[model samples]
Target: MKSVLAHPISQEMDSVAFEDVIVTFTWEERPLQGPSWRNPHKDVIQQILRNLSYIENQWRDQHIENQYKKILSDI
Candidate 1:
């Protein structure tokens, strides 16, 4: 599994990979926090996004290993 996060302003892609899968997450700065669902604080949103990316990376790593092991066991 491969995961990537793209920064629009910097136009760069931060990526991580595991086995044969890939995933991506991206973020953009928003003003006024328009809706209730939107975070009122930009810092809080940034932290949450970072945590989510980390979790996804860990999950993919474990998942890919499990899949590969299973495939080999079937042989």
Candidate 2:
């Protein structure tokens, strides 16, 4: 995960192979909104990574919470 989080993410990722099939990803970004989201090089990598981590944590917590709720419901 560190390797994934280490680099900037705004650039196009193209595609990759899983095992039997291939998968692709394409992203076309608009303009960055806030001053903090801006990069002089016209890159939003850092902000993208930050947002990705935030969403990852949020979804992870939500998944765990749902699992707990399910277990509680079984009780």
Clashes of each: 5, 0
Clashes of 2: 0
Worst 10 residues of 2 by lDDT: 23-32
| Tens-digit per-residue lDDT, 10-70, candidate 1 | 7676665554453333455445336663545556669979999999999999999999999
lDDT per residue (tens digit) for residues 1-75 in model 2: 354567677767767555546333344343434566445424655776789999999999999999999999999
Q: How accurate is candidate 1 locally (lDDT)?
A: 0.73
TM-score of 1: 0.44
Predicted candidate 1, C-alpha RMSD: 14.1
Where is model 1 poorest over a 10-residue stretch in terms of lDDT? 23-32
All candidates: CA RMSD (Å):
14.1, 16.2
